[model samples]
Target chain A: MPSISLTLNGRSVSGEVETKTLLVDYIRENQKLTGTHVGCDTSQCGSCVVHVDGKSVKSCTMLAVQVDGSEVTTIEGLATGEELHPMQEAFRQNHGLQCGFCTPGMVMSAVDLVAGNPDISETEIREGLEGNICRCTGYHNIVKSVQAGAKAMGG
Target chain B: MQNFDYHKPNSVDEAVANMQASDDGKFLAGGMTMLPTMKQGLAAPEDLIDLHGIDGIAGVAEGADAIEIGAMTSHSVVASSALIQSDLPALAALAESIGDRQVRARGTLGGSISNNDPAADYPAALVALGATVKTNTREIPAEDFFVEMFETALAEDEIVTSVSFPLVEKAAYAKFPNPASRYAMVGVFVAKNADGVRVAVTGAGPSVFRASAMESALDGDFSSSALDGVAVSADDLNSDIHASPEYRAHLVGVMAKRAVDACG
Candidate 1:
């Protein structure tokens, strides 16, 4: 087991993990932050997305030790004590989710997308969310939520 | 995934030494493909040498006549680089079109080309641009780098350092991506330089290949119309559930034309 330390959410955290322990598994199991879902276990689904050093990455694809000394942000870190992140609020207002299984990853990925390009167009939004699959909504309201979320984030 | 001993080497030499010491060691780059392959039980190595700790292998530099991109440079970084966009917009566009947002954020040029996935987009760009792939040991021309599907000219311990792409008069890449996985069903990259015109096709065959017929036509006249009667043989093309060999053959011509039009 490798002893690794990283800034998870906002605070510094350290743990011993197996070499094959995925970042998502470490976060969900060791840290007990179950907000991040593992919808596909594979990298195709965006359900396991998290910010590693401010860049959105598929957590399921990265080893836990690989994130040592880096800052990691998950869906749980987005909200500030009851005040939902603007993207979360937008998802709520626009009904961006249905089953809610994919919301966390969707929101995290969307925040990074909007942060990268504040003035993202609809086509760009659709293309940016290519990694996220939503079988329920057909992405109609999800696109709407991201558009609204971008505006709320001062885009 | 099988449990393995992990080693983080701070230098390319150290990484190579660690790999040599292990019974079955694999160098881990971004791990976008390596990790997934491990999870699927396709590969099982006794030791994993992580190269992320190695510095000076993950940036981009502009040379006098060509642009040198470090092996660890992520697709997102390449796609968003202002220098690359200004000088080699075709490569930037090609980088942007790979996989998706998250995959692009983590996938690296070295890993993609090293794996040499037959359907990968980078091989087409490398072959068409006549880029030079630099390893820790030596430099290899792109034409000789990719040998076949899931194979490259890399030695077990050789690490790709950087790739140098010469600035061209014009270049563009067009791909018909598989809707489910976004892997190129048929991708074409065309480049015109002082040397001449080069056309490379991927996702349509066992390996990325040069389209000499289309290259000669475009060498005479660099235009989409020049590919009117040019055709790629379907004899060696890949046929899967996603696309037929004949369909992929047709797409090679169509995508090559699109790439030429995009260059203009």
Candidate 2:
């Protein structure tokens, strides 16, 4: 087993994990951060997305050991005590999610997208969300939510 | 995925040593393809050598007449790089069209060519651009690097260091991607250089191959009209549920023309 240490959500965390332990599994099973859903074990579904060193990546496709010494931010870390992150607040205000299965990943991916290009266009947003699959087919609202979130984040 | 010992080597030599010492070992780049294959039980290596820890192998540089991109450089980096965008926008556009944003954030140029997925887009660009694939041992021309589907000329202990793409007068790539996977159903890359025109097609065949007939036609006129009645033979094209061989053959002509037009 490899002893891995990483800054999770803002705190230093360490664990002894098998080489095959996926980052998603390490977060969900070991660290009890269940907010990051596992909609598709494969990389197709971006439901397992998390921020690794400020970049969005599919946690399920990466090994826990691979992220050792990196900064990981899950959905649970998005909120500030009582206040929701602007993206989460926008999702709440715009009704971006249905059944809430893909919301976390969608929100995380959208945040990164808007952060990279604050002036993103509608077509760019649609293309940017290609990696995430919303089973409920509620992309229209999701796009609106991201637009609102982007504006709220001063994009 | 099966349990395998992981080794993170700081240098190329150390990574190769780790691979040579293990009975069965695999070098992991971005894990975009290798990890999924392992998860599906399609591949199981006894030892996994992670190449991410190695420094000085993951950036882009520019020379007088060409661009040198490190093997570990991610697609996103290449796609967004100002240097590549200014000097080689066609390659940058091709990189941006790969997979999606998240995959582009992780998938590396080296890994994509090394895997040589029949439907991958990079092989077409490499072949058409006349790129040189640099390795730990020697430099392999793009034409020789790709042997067949999912196979390359890379030796067991060799590791790709970087790739050098020569600047051309004009170049463009166009692809009809499979809707679901974004892998090219039929992709074409056309380039016009000092020597002449080179056209490479992927996803329609078992491996990336040059379209000599279309190249010759374009070399004469360097316009899409030159390929007016030209056609690619369907004899060696791949036939799958997504497209029939004849359909892919048709796409080869269509995409080649599109690429040529986009080159302007």
How would you encode candidate 2's per-residue C-alpha lDDT over A20-111 as one tens digit per residue?
A: 88899999999999999998756898999999999999998899999999999999999999899999999999989989988899999999
Q: Supply candidate 2's per-residue lDDT for B28.
A: 94
lDDT of 2 by residue, B134-235 (tens): 999999999999999999999988899899999999999999998778899999999999899999999999999999999999989999999999999999
Label model 2 with its docking quality class.
high
Best candidate, lDDT-wise?
Answer: 1
TM-score of each: 0.99, 0.99
- Model 1, residue B138: distance off in Å is 0.5
**lDDT score, candidate 2, position A154:** 78
